[model samples]
Target chain A: MESDKKIVWLASYPKSGNTWFRAFITALLNNGEVDINNLATDGIFSSRRLFNEQTDLESNLLYDEEAKQMQGNVFNHICAKAKQRHLFVKIHDAYTYNSDNLPVIPTQNTLCAIYIIRNPLDIAGSLANHKDDTLDDSIDFMNNKQSVFGKQEDEVNTSLQFRQPLLDWSGHVNSWTAKLPFPVMVIRYEDMLADAFETFKQALLFMGIKTDKQQLETAIAASSFEQLKQKETDYGFKERIRNTSFFRSGKAGNWKNELTSQQVSAITSQHQNTMAKYGYI
Target chain B: MYYYRGFGLIIASQIMLPELLPYTLTSTPDVHISIGKTPEKLTAAGTVHKVGYAINPNEYLLQFLNVANYYAANGNNIIVEPLAGSDEKSVRLFLLTGVMAAILHQRNAVALNAAAIKHLDGVVLFCGYAGSGKSAMLTKFIQNGYKPFCDDVCLIQHNDVKAMAAYPTIKNWENTFTGMGLPIPSTDNKIRPNLPKYATYFHDEFDTDALPVKTIFIIHKDHIAKSVEIKKLAGIEAFAEVHNNVYHRLQIYPMKKEAIHFQAISKLVANINVYQVTRSSNTGFDELFQTIQKHL
Candidate 1:
């Protein structure tokens, strides 16, 4: 890999601050002046449209042979454009997928990998609130390997209780942290919020991106929960954004008020170690 | 409504997904199938199993794409694509394996327009838009120690695990293969010529499992610059760039499922990273490949 090009594998199952963190990092790295009220979220690494082809941008649709091949070609273009300053992404599929197989770009230029883990209990509450499924439903889907939006017969019987959320939480974290083919720097959303500046500093260092005290304070203040929410109202509703408010609540421990006792125990029992690591229990 | 089989999936349209392609069921897996066409006799092939409701033709075509034109328009994700049959030749039972992949990506787990094949190094999409360099790349990749997932066209089926592409043919274009600076399309079973009777270009001897869509590199030659350039795109921008440059970007005919299809591609684009490849990158083809190797 080229010494400068970065391959930041921002792994997290779903709603584990993957997007939230991605949004914040987007704000910070751009001009190093964080905009707490309104953050920008458009990049080759996200789901937004760079080309005017006007194709659907849903996250679960299937691609035909031509479309798939085209994606590879365009991705090569994007990687070259971003060079070392770009954010190459992976949705955390567990398998260490290397891009070199296709020979689309300078494979050796890969430089960095980053992973983010959040409390599953909190994530479950958020997903259930936003999406139609529940934590229990998500769990079964996770273990079983299917989705409510999908057909039934081919579905597996993992028997997850609110499995979607749990799986999102577990899959996102475990896939990257447990056993990785490459080195990755893991960050917890809770820990990020618990001590914003410290976490921010660590993240920068991991990327070899050094920042002074001023930049540190600026990134922190810009990424603050309150600042992000206000930005969501303005930029969140913007049509260009996939979602107007990319930032939801950044507080930790909200699981206590949001989840039912059963949900709590289910998450604790299911993801006990991970939850405990972040002191979510 | 009827059931169709190919690869390992029992494509049952009409009953389960309300949003499948509109097409009648044909028992046999025929790439020459059309949205309005159905086999005279429904031949029961267990290759495809239908468990849900009776599959309909319209929904099936809408879902798994039965026509060649429709595939040519929007099925850009496919690697081993079926040739759209010009005066020169036609591609049948085409399969596509996405090269430049994501870790454990299943971007095309369902859909009839594609197929896959796994090899030692990973997956290499056998792709091109007639002039986009599909066979040329295939021959070169093979000569460079790569394997085949499909030739010009690939076969695909949906399954419980994911959408899969089928191994078909190399159909090494004699002159074209040599043009790519590789051996003449060898007699290897993996390689074959387009057979006129079977409605396919060639019977490729090899193929692999479902690989995720990794990157998209456009092939355009700049006589002046004579180099290839690579760049990365982030978020919606990357998705848009990829979805449009796709040869079949406008295949919806009525464009009814444009939004739905875009969302589907977006999900795929979101999960994996995307990039652009300059035609031959300012460096010659080999240097371009080396450049991609070093950075990606």
Candidate 2:
């Protein structure tokens, strides 16, 4: 019945600029030194470890629907018991309600949300590499309205994460933007690439993080794509797919070279409304 | 009624627990379990704890959705109230694990979230976050001729730091059975309803005798590496590793059992060798077995 308004959500679809933003925040918080393996944020929103620790329940033992319904309780518990003044959580689940018609992520515990949007064409290529699937599979995954991760039953014994339902790319964006119970800030992947300094500064300011121009510039440089890729190469990123790189080419318009015309058409056709609304088209 | 041996205690239960080895000792039971009507909420008993459980110095109550509610008091009794139409396997699974764990905490014992295997002169522990290949490595060890000590949870007494097996069942995923080229036993029951995981009983091979705490291997995952690496942890890091691996550590503070938990961890850390085994994504269990074979 009590509220713990300390959660700042970092939400995005897969292969968007979520990790990059996390890296920036990590570096910003750590005097401009970020360990690719250890980010400064609280772990992912769907982390099974956090779920088990917070609720004293074994998520792997429960059915997907049973666990999904308990997420609001888990997050609220996390907020209530958190020692940190501001707990930043990276999330991939769309803004959806539970079976109880209450938000899966309790609005009472949320301080704010930073929703990162990316071009679907670019996402298809990156998602393919991340998921160990083909480009076609990735495209279908992006367009599928019932897209979800960590749903395999066999993985119940070995996975460190729980199920995350993403809906579709369009649905994912609309779920966060259409109705807002908390303050929400939308950042585009392309804009981050275009003006890293201003885009990141605005994000920090939006979170009420105070830093001078020098510290912000230094943190940005420390978390540059090259730096993150090099760190991954040197120390091996835990988030990377077993055989693939997580910090693959960070350019915004690489879709022009990577995705075929048909692939682009498929994405645009499925997510045209969202793409146009965000000026991606 | 059925008699069983778990958490270094004799258990006489009204419900069937097919996973635990049958009790053979003639001594009186340390714990008794029976069917009873439990309160919907435990506010009257004590302060409501986190995760909907309630606890005081000696009594603890926990509920599993659509399964059963379990109450433990003074480390000697457990009361189960099953939901209507609840399956026996589901009810017993919760009773044997979470309920038993709560009971252990009440007894001032430290329950670890790791599998225990008989190695050398004592038991060696394989612990990590879920999916860190602890069970796979334990399975590999079993295939290679080592004895199974305990699966899932390994209990340590707070007063003596002796390692104890609460139950002798390996609750493994269905694929673990097939992946090892073995068929799942026809009698194997699902650990929970609507889940592919099954509890494989080790009644004949389970070691019931208390053993001295020995070596512990903490498995880790390295995404990009091509081979496995093992490192020895000493001093504070080793202490923290063992302390953090306590089963349901989040429940300790709420139960006001931090003193017992801390004392048990400190005793275990002082007496054991803790090693961290980092397995690359491409590394197979055989290579991990080979890497660990030299240490033991």
Question: Highest TM-score, which number?
Answer: 2
Candidate 2: true contacts recovered, fraction:
0.66
Residues A175-198, candidate 2: write the lDDT tens digits. Answer: 998768888999999999999999
Q: For candidate 1, write residues A1-281 as lDDT tens digits.
A: 45445556565655566655655575567755454334443233322233212222211122222233234333444455564565646442332222334422123444556777777777675665444466666555433332322121212111111012123355446655664445678888888877877887887788777678786776667666776567656544221112223455667778777777876776677667766765666
Off by over 4 Å in 1: A32-77, A88-109, A134-168, A235-246, A277-279, B1-296
Q: Count steric clashes of candidate 1.
A: 171
Compared with the true structure, the alpha-carbon lDDT of candidate 1 equals 0.42
lDDT, candidate 1, at B56: 20
Instruction: Report per-prediction Cα RMSD to one decimal.
Output: 22.4, 2.8
Q: What is the TM-score of each candidate against the true structure?
A: 0.43, 0.91
DockQ of each: 0.01, 0.56
DockQ of 2: 0.56
- Count clashing residue pairs per candidate: 171, 1
